[model samples]
Target: MKKYFTQLSYLLDSQAKKTIPLLILSFLFSSVLDVIGVGLIGVFLGLLTNPHFFLQKFPDLAFLLQGLSEKKIIGLFGVLIIVAFAVKAILTLLIQAKVIFFCQLLLVRLKNRMMIAYQYAPYTYHLQRNSSYLISRIQDNIGSFIGNVFLPLLNLISSGFIAISILSLLAILHPFITLFLVSMFFSVGLVFDLFVKQKLSSMGKIVSLSNGEMIKTIHHSLHGLTEIRVLGREDYFLQWLSKISHRYAHAAGILVALQQIPRYLIENMIAIFIIGLTLGGIAAGFSISGVVAMVGMFAAAGARLLPTVTQIMSAINQIRGYLYQTQLVYEELVELESITKGSKKIKSLYQKFDKLTFSTIFLSNVNYQYPHTDYSALKNVNITLHKGQSIGLVGPSGAGKSTLVNVILGFLEPESGQLLIDGKPIDNLREWLNNFAYIPQIIFLLDDTLRRNIALGIDDHEIDEDRITKVIQMAQLTEVVQQLPEGVDTLLGENGVRLSGGQRQRVALARAFYHERDVIIMDEATSSLDHETEQEVINTIKTLKGNKTLIVIAHRLSTVENCDILLRLEKGRITKVGSFADVVGISS
Candidate 1:
């Protein structure tokens, strides 16, 4: 229980920390009300069975009943009982509604906070993690944390308070008998929990694991649909998902059954215990009225007490069954918080600067090694790039062309190097990166209007129409936009599935143009275009040669032959650097 509470603390933010204590205090008030309602019912039963007993027991109020007939007294007590019960019911409902609303609100806030952390986390953090796992952590795991762990924990606490309150009232009435009954109930409950605790915990872990696997399987199968269909292996992915689904269903079913099974057993035990109590009372030679009143009071207490005990046990079982999710989500929350701790300050610093103003960027003695690798991806690499120079990189596959680009883009940091802007070290990488527009080999598009995709992060009202039109023409996407039914308003489908390869490339180029950055980096951006289109785009790029700093990586010789400077890289080192003809060993 202590460990679970610790894990819960890790999941809560400052607001939740404050809200939880207030909620628990409310639970305490609710439990007091439960005791009051039950105590009133006991007094009501005592009067119904033996009016003289109440007159003798609560003698201070005996004068009020002197003029009243028995029926009138019973009728008045009945009204009091109804009112007590009604108040308890109303308060319970209000408390429950508050609990549900708090859990839901916390769920939303936690999910949003986690997403923001992921967005601001270092690029290396994303490279090491799987997208499917991260997605499930956000969508599925946090929900399980709330429903299975936090809600059940709250129920356990609330039920526990009510059970103790009811038990205390019963003890005040019949001390020895209540003590024996509580001992018996607690002994039975303890034995049952010991029997099922390990099994329930194991099943919970299995459920968490299976949920993540199922999500990963589905993510992979959907993302690789074309490959699966081409390979004629639909059953392969289906079988994988089927196996995980079966495991998840089986574990989840067991947890549900185990949590509820205790209620039935505990209910029967309470019934048997009450019967024995009545038999024992009769054996003590009490008069009929006395025994009836005693039994009535005990029965009323039992009625309220039994359900609370059962609820407490059920809540314990649920917490045990979902313990793994609690721990998993706790760890995730802690890790995300630590990773994004400095992100806010960094983001603020990034916002302090506008467009970067620099004539040169120099990589001084840069060195980078990939995680868990013996070899450096960029070893003693040095390069200088001037603004308004069209530079090209030509390299073979796996020759570190992309790594160098990533380093230059500030996605990867060198072990020992300084990225200098205008001959001074750049202290703020985020601001520096914001001044560049990057186009990668692969394009990712949102399922939104083409216009929104082009101006991806801009608000609708803030988008400049004239600038959009100009970029559309510059990227050679004017014809494509006109061909669409709604022009730029047409939906692009998921990841631009509706567009052809060249058209997608054109859209990417259009997006870059819309950003209007001082530096444009294209990593094989025109590889998807046909010969004529590629040449036309290259010519468009040539037009920006003297205006914007352009860095282009291409395998095709003709692609960079007209550049102001060309570089050839091999095995993480720059092998050649000159104008195209000088580097290629051919006269211009």
Candidate 2:
């Protein structure tokens, strides 16, 4: 329990300082009101049964109420009972209102934190994990954390305060009955805990795993819609999703059943205890007033204590069921430590990027091997690229062309040698990435307006129309824009599905032009384009020859015909380094 609380505190961070105290104050207030309300019920009933009793005990009671008869006393006490109960109800609802609102608000903050952590994590961390799993952690898993851990923890605390307050008041009024009630009900709760602890733990694992699998199935179906349709295997994925979803639902339902069954069992036992107390009062030969006061007190305490005990039990079950989920949140909350291991000194947002000019990139016998792999992806790779040079890399499949680009981009750090930019080793790869425009074969576009797609992260109002028009012309997309009814305002569906392959490539090129970076890295950007369209893009590339650095990576050697220098690679080593024709003949 202490460990769980510590994790919760960590998850809340500085907000725990405020939220924790507020929760304590609210629950404490509600419990105090409840205790006062229950005590009054006994006083009200005692007045109705025998006002002479109080009158004799305090003779001043009759003197203080000059015009009051027994009837008037009854009426006044009855009104006081109603008012006390009404105030208690309002306070309880107010406590719940504050707690629920704060919990939901905290949920949004937690979601934002999850996204921020993912953004800060290194690129290799993402490569090692599936995107769908991360999405599940952010989406479904956090929801479970709220339902199974966060809110339940709150419920457990508030109910614990209410139960203890009522039990203490009952002990003051009738010690023997309080002892009996505690021994009976608490013992039963202990027994139930021993009965279902293991089952709930297993169910927790099932629900967490099954939910993630269901989400994975959905991600696969949505992202691979074209492939599924072509292979006529849509039903296979559908069935897989349903199977996992049903497993998740079943586990969740059983865990809820485990949580709920205790409440009803505790309620039934409390009802029998109440009946037994009433009969015991009659058998004890007490006066009508004494019996009425005793029985009323027990009834009032039971009315409050029963539900409090039930909720406390429910919360205990919640903690047990979501132990794993707490661990999940704790891990993600601290994932930043892994990302901070190597380069703990990079904080460039915009200013450093403007001055991030480089003279040359020198690779010194760089070697990299993927984990759990037999061969090195890049072995003793030696390359030196000067500023404002158009360099092309051509190699066969599995010849480490992509691996070399990733190393240069700092996505994967070399295991053996150093990558020096302008003769200085760079600790901050992110700052270096800011100076590059990576135009991949596949452009990731959202289902949004063309202007927003081109200016990806900027708001619609912040998009510069002049810059958009200039890039469109540079990428030879002006003619395509003229045909669209909305022009740059046109909507591109998922991954630019609305445009043809060539048109999408041009949109990507226009985006690169819009970025206006010092280095543009194109990875088979014109692989899917026709000969005429590819030549047009190549002409645009030739126009930027001496002004900007271009690193063109492709399998088709013809695409690098105008490159100033070409590096031909075979089996992770440079075979030839010369003019395009010199390397193209040997590579082809």
Candidate 3:
């Protein structure tokens, strides 16, 4: 409970401070109206005991009461009661509106911060984590935090204030009666609290775990639908889903049962307390009217207090659940100590190359091991690439071709030895990456126009229409664009689903071309293309003789036949590097 309150306090403080004040004002107004309503009932009771109570106390009261008959007085009291209710309703609405607005604003800020952090986060963080889970944390979990946790907390606080105010009024009216009622209420609450505390926490953990699993399952089902159908595994998937559903149902049932038990217990206790108190008052020589007024006030207080207690208890449990989930997301967002901003600006890519003046770049005694792996992916590897060179890396499946590219791109930090960029140690690889553009095996395009996709938010001053046209032609995407309804302005569907694999790969290639960086790294960039398109793309690469450095990775041996250099990788080690003919042992 203490931990829950601590977490709630931190959450509230993170939101706008004005939210708290509005909540307090809302609670005060509602509680004041409830107490005033009870006071009005007491006044009516006094009037019933003595018709001219006010008239006899002060003669001026008769003038003030002129033209107001008993029926009229009752009607006026009713009007006052309705007005009080209206005021409470208005205040409640405003408070809720403020809470919703503030919670949403806070959620938006949190998501934005996480996104910005992700861009700066170490690549190892992404390599070790699931993209779906990270996406869920930023998009789904933040929303849940606001709705399930923060909103309920605000209600709990408001309800608590109202409950306290009513109890205080009851105490002022009759201390003994107030004490008896308060004790009875808390005793029942304590019993319920004890009964459900552990159970709620346990149920909360199960629900949270189940939620993550469900998301994982759905993500896999969508992404692998084609594979599932091809393999005829529909029944297998359904059986797995049924198991998950069963566990979810079991946990949900237990949670509902725990939640309701307290509600029923509290209600019965309130009913018995009201009856006993009224009977006691009548036996203690109180008039029937006095007993009636006492019972009426007690009932009103109970009505307010019962829901208030239940809501607070429920909110606490929910806060616990949300905090558990939030902690998982928070752990991912926290910064790693290793990543730091580059101390010096790499103003020019040519400066490093000019200094090195070497015909060949070398990686000697290199080693790299992935996290949670005992064996090194690349062990004692040695390799070299010449200046202004085109190198093709070839290997069978799981032969570390992608790993080598990741190392060159500085996406992975080698466990031992060094990676050199133009003979300069790759300490600030992020800064070094500015000189290179990478096209991955899998192409991803935004849901935007072809022109925007190629330009990629580059300013008008930076835009080169001639360059875009040249690359589109080189990538063999001229026909694809020409056929589109809007030509270059045609919007692509999500993930470029509207485009064929070959077309999507060409678009990605065009984007790399438009970047016009010093070095280009293609990781199976043409694997999705057919023989004709691949030939066109290879021809495009050949045309870039003096323009930029090119490093290509391809499974097809014919793809690298015209390359200036070729690097053959066996396991983690680079076994050979030479001109294509020299490596292939053939005269060109």
> Evaluated with TM-score, which candidate comes out highest?
1
List model 3 lDDT by residue over 1-588, tens digit each: 675555445444345565678667867777787677666655555465555644664577578678899767666666776787677778778767877887888878767766765665667777887776667677767677777677777777777777788788889877898898778767876776777778766776676666666677777777788899999887876777678777878876787666666567777888998899888988999988668767876877777777776776667666655666665545555443123333232223213332223344567677998898888888787777765788788766667888888877667778988777566676544456766777776766779888878877687578788888998997678999989999888999877878876687678778877876667787874445468656744774687655667888887777777677888887887777788887777888
In order of appearance, the predictions have TM-scores of 0.95, 0.94, 0.85
lDDT of 3 at 16: 58
Which tens-of-lDDT digit does each residue in 365-479 have in candidate 2?
9998887688898889899999899998888877888888888887778989989998888766557877788877777787987877777787777888999999888878899
Please list the C-alpha lDDT of all candidates, in the order they appear.
0.82, 0.81, 0.71
Candidate 2 deviation (Cα RMSD): 2.5
Angstrom error of the Cα, residue 62, model 1: value is: 2.3
Better of 1 and 3 by TM-score: 1
How does candidate 3 score on lDDT? Answer: 0.71
Worst 10 residues of 1 by lDDT: 342-351
Error of 3 at 558 (Å): 2.5
Q: Give the poorly placed runs of model 3, Cα more than 4 Å off.
A: 1-22, 25-30, 45-76, 335-365, 381-387, 422-430, 447-449, 456-470, 489-500, 525-537
RMSD of each: 2.1, 2.5, 4.8
Q: Order of all candidates by lDDT, from best down to worst?
A: 1, 2, 3
- Tens-place lDDT per residue, model 1, 1-588, is 698778877778899999989999999999998888888777777787777757877889898888998889888889988898899899899999999999999999989977876776777888898888888888888898889878988988998899888888888888998899889888889899889999899999888888889889998899999999999998999999999999999998988888887788778888888788778878988777767776777777778877787888888888788778777777876776675565553454325566667888888888888888999888777889888899998888777888898888777878888667788876676677767888775677899999999998899999999988998998888999999999999999989888876687778778888887778887884445468655754875678788778888887868877788988888888889889998899997
**Decreasing TM-score order of the candidates:** 1, 2, 3
